[model samples]
Target chain A: MTKFNFELTKEIELLRLVTVGSVDDGKSTLIGRLLVDTKGAFEDQLMAVRKKKGTVKVSSAAEIDLAMLTDGLSAEREQGITIDVAYRYFATPKRKFIMADCPGHEQYTRNMVTGSSTANAAIILIDARHGVLAQTKRHTHILGLLGIPHLIVAVNKMDLVDHDQATYEKIREEMKEYCAKQGVRDLICIPMSALTGDMVSVRGDNMDWYKGDTLLETLESMSVLDDLDEKPFRMPVQLLNRPQTADLPDYRGFMGTIASGTVKVGDELVVKPSGKISTVKEIVTFDGNLQEAFAPQSITIILNDEIDISRGDMLMHVGQEDSDSKFLTANVCWIGDEPLETRKKYLIKHAASEVKAMVSEVNFKTDIHTLAQDEADELAMNEIGRVTFKLQQPLNYDKYADNRTTGSFIVIDSFTNNTVGAGMIV
Target chain B: MSEHKLTQLKALEAESIHIIREVVAEFRNPVMLYSVGKDSSVLVHLARKAFYPAPFPFSLLHVDTGYKFKEMYDFRDAFCEEIGADLIVRKNEDAINKGMNPKEFGVARCCQALKTTGLLDALEEGGYDAAFGGARRDEEHSRAKERVFSMRDEFGQWDPKNQRPELWNIYNGRIHDGESVRVFPISNWTEMDIWSYIREEKIEIVPLYFAKERPMIERGNMLIPYYEENKDQLLEGEVPKMIMSRFRTLGCSPCTGAVRSDATNMDEIVIEAAAARRSERETRIIDHGSNSMEDKKKEGYF
Candidate 1:
């Protein structure tokens, strides 16, 4: 009855991870193993999976169809393929994890991008028997573009490869090379059989030569709070909290979730687009007033002097504000079925600001298999490429590598309001 | 002086606050669907924080089935008044006028007419362009693939297959005049997380969540409470018993089931929830089938 130590688990950090691989790379099996081994999967959920008719055996030792655990849609079950992203949750005493189960089909690259967008780390599965495939490179390239801080290459299906040390090493070498080319800075390779539970959660004795930590260990120990705290201050004003109450008639507060950096009381801040400067009078929350607040904390800020800071305006550290520009160069992943037409107006939403924008030019598109830049006039659905955009107004932003929150944006079709593209400031 | 990083709970709170703020900022008229459940209690708490020191700009909509437990209505009225927010209660007057009930019509049709149709009717009447719900991805299978900003057609029909791809934290709230958006601020939260946060924040919930010796009748592995709302649904041979039970989920008295447990306090409930094998949805008879929830959602059931 006391198996779950709830008292010992307090104030645990949240880690967001995503799974990416080709369609048959055992991504679902790996996730199913993590949930089951950690006791995160409930009995009813497992029973439902076990009760499915014609369940495919993913691992020899596993009694349940692990891949069926995450395929939620009836159509997905019928086709035996994932079409969209499914989010899963689990927890250990030390941390809470939100795993984004992304599909690997070429047509569903949009789903993978959506899943990887907020992930702090990504686990890219590489079949040990197939070595590195085109889907691996494509996912790696997309992950690199999304600026996922950590990459764990799980060399799965080792049992099919006879658990040979040479095969794992070969795939690891090729992945390391390709990941490096894709600008993956932090990478770790592990050899495991997701089906057989070898080196996934508890290291099964099948792979004695593998010396690295298990997949669960690697995820649990990943440092999620990157240099976000050290980055320059950026907070997009989401709302102007003007509480004209009887007791508090003069309250004019700015509200937002600090995109990055830390802010303290009496700190000097400049409101963008107006260049108005003011000092922080107080940081307010429902609990109480705070002297200091940092990135990802939603709080209200009161200024020493009155300023016309409206929604969509950025409050930044003095001399650290990104200059506004009407033209932007960036890499984009087209997600809409409708091809990207140059000179067609689209709504570009970045942070809290939305403005009319048009694709000025398509610099080039990258081939998924060869990683080669080819000339293309239009970016089709699920295509990754570099494109230039001309905005109707000046936008203040930073490079995607420097600040993901402020640098990333989504392209929306003006007529349909569908998210057509995901762009990163270069 | 603390570290700059936020705990998991705090981070979730911050995220939820941000989303609530965004909904208020973008849409002209937005409403939060408060079901008087644990999730709705947390959502109301977050909404209170989202616009502290100022009156909430939107109203809290409660779709009443006229079959909820009496304790739920009492809690809902008192809780809304305590927070000083506007509350709008809507009912399927047409269905009620026709004498529609679960036992006679069935759970699926009853839900469709009472909850889904009632919700859509209220939303259209209020001209609300965006409505927030307390749906979590971990609760059901189909919900795991739902977008934070789920778009619905002019008639409030959801096309799950053609949903717009959501990326990053940038949400697309733009929609045509007739269309509306259903935003889930706590989409990523799990059931355990909900209980843990409830205990941490000390949020007041309905007393139904606490175990008590209430009159109940056994119905096919379900512990159905013997109340005025469900008195007529009893079979010939069934008998009511005074059992120590509590609800895992809340709905109409006839559709929801109670689990036998001794967990009366928040701490005990958290421990029990952590160790329990069955999911919370299993107790809600409306979600018995594999595709019922999905089908209901497509018909605009929040």
Candidate 2:
């Protein structure tokens, strides 16, 4: 096959994942083992780390701190704690993976949210000795909240417990019960020793009692494409690609990124807010003509005839028809220093559109540990709460559970010009 | 194209284009910071595509340190002419004339006075409300925490501890007067992705990136390039050695190091970069100083 053909096939088979776990739970070790055993680590990097191991004043007792392979910062090396989301790319013959190694500290929840926001799957690590801690519960709840379809509970440090089946089963049962309570349906549990390379990319003799697909095999087999493109068509106009100069006075085109679904030429579409109907004339990009443009693609669309359209306008399928726009009831993860105050006007940016929104009411706050709902007037830092928002204008959106691209938004602090919180429309 | 993969790249591209458009729509006066590097080249390319057939809405801002490779300036001028984009060049000639060499004030201080101050002064003078940068999150730890619409205070300071939560593709570029926002459209892209895109797009870059015969000296593992008049600052232990070398990253000539390589073309460079373990910044003597990038960033260094 040609190089282009190989790359096309490889791109189709790639899996993007974000790993989350509390401090020192062997998340980095798992990634390192996966990279090392798979021969993903370059020869020079391995040798350099080995030669400079204990000799470096920054590192701890050498022995190839596997975390060094991913964590690029010198401060991160000295602290032995991941502060920001570090992305690493590696490929197996079966599949390519781009893993976002997010910081596990509770304080860096924003970083974790950013990392896992674009992930198709999540690997939530749990230490066998500690069982399911507060941070583990937090991560699981956040994953569920983020609408991550696939969850892998990697019960790391199993070797410390002699790779006992009972311990793994107990932790798995607890996680399963908690996830079920939080409405997380798709979850898989595996026991492994990240430090010793057990049940990571390949099966190990240490886990003879466990029979399932290896982590690598599971990663390869998981379906990523089906989950993203199955949603409805939603396009947010980004710009108007028409030059109103003398050369192209009559030329007009609505340019935007398609948030979801496929749009083809001759398809009937409705421009939201203005409620103007138009037929797709052409889909244009920097490259040659595209017959049709699908979800997530940024392209300029020319209509058969000109209709009034501007930025922040949504284009949807006319036949399918969307539900009546109304006030949004959403589960919000408050990230600001100050607690969320009800009845405050803030800038709410959803997808490609931004509008003035006010918090109509506070529904309740979720307890990260207990997964219980409580009536609260305000939401503090790292608090998850359900709130009602009244927008100045109705926004065209889907339910967060159905479509993450259209249903999510961030609340900006008007005075400080800071992004204070994140919300997912229910 | 397959239905699935097309959807993925489309989504990423759409978001990026939306961001570029927002930078144009929201800011009163916005300019793009072009470094003549792959990242900035891709940024300019995206901008052209974002608002095609309508010459880029914003001007290109280049902070010339006067110590850059001659090839970079040549490429910059040629690219600007070809794209029909307005170019604004800023330099700290006053400081340079005052003997403010990198050797005197160290790499961090020199960069602070020359590049960062030059950029700030240009922004202030141009009355730009927003500046589009080509910084990617995958480049460094601090950058990974950066927002697509990064807000800079009145003094142009970045507070790492407190940052806005960026959700979905929606960016909030709203800021007060006298405070400008630094917009990064390609924050999600990695080093490999930049190279891959450059290769795929056939974007033209400086020839200094490819290996060629150049006068240089050996200083610690890095090949220090020798320029006129700056040879007196060489340490006693460092030896002057002539070798075929190229710059992995473009910066002030004194601080940036050259690597010995035969990868004179894009394809060979890509292969060599892929196999190389060390980061592009590792060879630079500027970053070798104690948390230099972070310290500079804290002091409003771009």
TM-score for the B chain of model 1: 0.97
lDDT of 2 by residue, A91-185 (tens): 65555576778888998887788778777899999999999999888888888999888999999999999999999999999999999997887
- In model 1, what is the error at residue A37, expressed in angstroms? 1.1
Clashing pairs in 1: none
Q: Which candidate leads the pack in lDDT?
A: 1
Cα-lDDT of candidate 1? 0.88
Tens-digit lDDT track for model 1 on A332-394?
A: 999998999778789999999998998899999999766789999899998899999999998
Alpha-carbon lDDT of model 2: 0.78
Q: Which is the leading candidate under DockQ? A: 1
Model 2, B91-198: lDDT tens digits are 888777877777777776788888878888888889988999998765655665567887788888776555555565667787888888899898766565567666
Write down the worst ten-residue block by lDDT for model 2 chain B: B3-12
TM-score (C-alpha) between model 1 and the true structure: 0.96
After TM-score superposition, the amount by which residue B42's alpha carbon in candidate 1 deviates from its true location, in angstroms, is 0.4
Model 1: docking quality category: medium
How close is every model to the real structure, measured as TM-score? Answer: 0.96, 0.90
